[model samples]
Target: MEIKLVPVRPEDKGTLINLYQLYEHDFSRFTNRDIDKNGRYEVNIDFYWEGDERWNPFYIEVSGTIAGFLVVLFENMDIDPDPTHVIYDFMILQKYRRTGIGRAAAIKAFKMYNADWAVTQMENNTPAISFWRNVIKSFKEDNFTERYRPERKKYIQELSTKT
Candidate 1:
């Protein structure tokens, strides 16, 4: 399975919507809330409008099909620091799980952006936690931090590495 990163275009709205719905459904399993409510599901659309100046989105293609997507948000501290990229969301279709597509996509994103990237996984998703653990292990240079928020019963794992 050859994976490639394709820049997200306006014409890809349908595919992005489909992926967003799938991501929302998957997220609901851990949050126990319908994220589609209040049209929050349109966040991706908004991100697209916001343009690549700050956030950039990519479609992960495998065997010519869009198997997943990833969004990178660029940030800088104060006015003198170099910019860093964060993986705001990454989702691979259930059928494609464990196929190495996700890892390839992540590596591609890291190389394409050539900056630090971070991902946060909720504590409830043990599978995701383990998945990220392995990712960090394989990368071996990223720093991982765990933070707990009692109000939301959410645990966040932040991982980052310099390119």
Candidate 2:
């Protein structure tokens, strides 16, 4: 399946509300949030509509259908003098997962930004750990840095195109 990363337009908001709820449900497993009686989860996305220049939202498309969405943000965590690309959120529909589309999309995303990369995944998500490990390894080999931040209970990885 071919994956296309299309910039999510304002008209796509309603669809994203549902899709994002799906993502929230899956993510709730790693956090304290619980699925409501209706089997739905609520995550405030008001900021996404604020039209922030620092944030980007994209719909993951497969064969003209919306497979999922990815939210990328330019954030200055001030780890250094330069701002960095942060993959704030990424979710591929359950049906489209485990295929090569995700890996391809991630590689494409990194190349599109191409400065510095900082990615975090909940430590409880072993599959995410595996996915990030594979992508970073293929993109940076042993040149990348990864550490398990005990305070956040998340795996943090840093990479640079220069490396």
Candidate 3:
């Protein structure tokens, strides 16, 4: 399958909503809690499109369908107090995963940014943790650290390796 990264537009709001729902649903399955309220979720998504400086959302198109979404957030590092970009969220539809699409999209995003990038996955989401571990392992410099958040019961994996 061909993967394309496209700039998200206002017209793509519905598609973005669907993608967000997919994430919320999967996340709920792992955490056993609803992270989003019905109407409130849409509001948050709309806010992102309404010029949220922190988040830059993009559409991941596979073939002709909008398979998922990715958000690159400009954030300050907790350890070093330096500005950096983080892959805030990334999700591909269940049917479209494990076909190299996710890795391809990641590589594309890395090339486009040409800087240190980071991604965090929930600890219960073993597949995602494993996927990220493999990706980091393949790199020459796996500059990453995992921090456990007792309050959230999740491990935040931060990667700064970019080749």
**What overall lDDT goes with each candidate model?**
0.73, 0.82, 0.72
lDDT-wise, the better of 1 and 2 is 2
Location of the lowest summed lDDT over 10 successive residues in candidate 1: 35-44
Ranking by lDDT: 2, 1, 3
Candidate 3 TM-score versus the reference: 0.78
> Which residue runs of candidate 1 sit more than 4 Å off their true CA positions?
35-44, 76-81, 141-163
Candidate 1 local lDDT, 1-163, one digit each (tens): 7899888877877878878888887878886765555655444466565544666778899989989898887765335266767777889999899999888787777667545556666767888777766776576555666677777665565555554
TM-score of each: 0.79, 0.89, 0.78
lDDT per residue as tens, model 3, 72-163: 87775435445578888888889888888787777666666646666777778888888777766555245676677878776676666445
Q: Taking the tens digit of each residue's C-alpha lDDT, what string does model 2 give over 81-121?
A: 56788888989888888887788788778887757888899
TM-score of 2: 0.89
Kindly report which residue stretches of model 2 are placed more than 4 angstroms away from their true locations once superposed: 37-39, 77-81
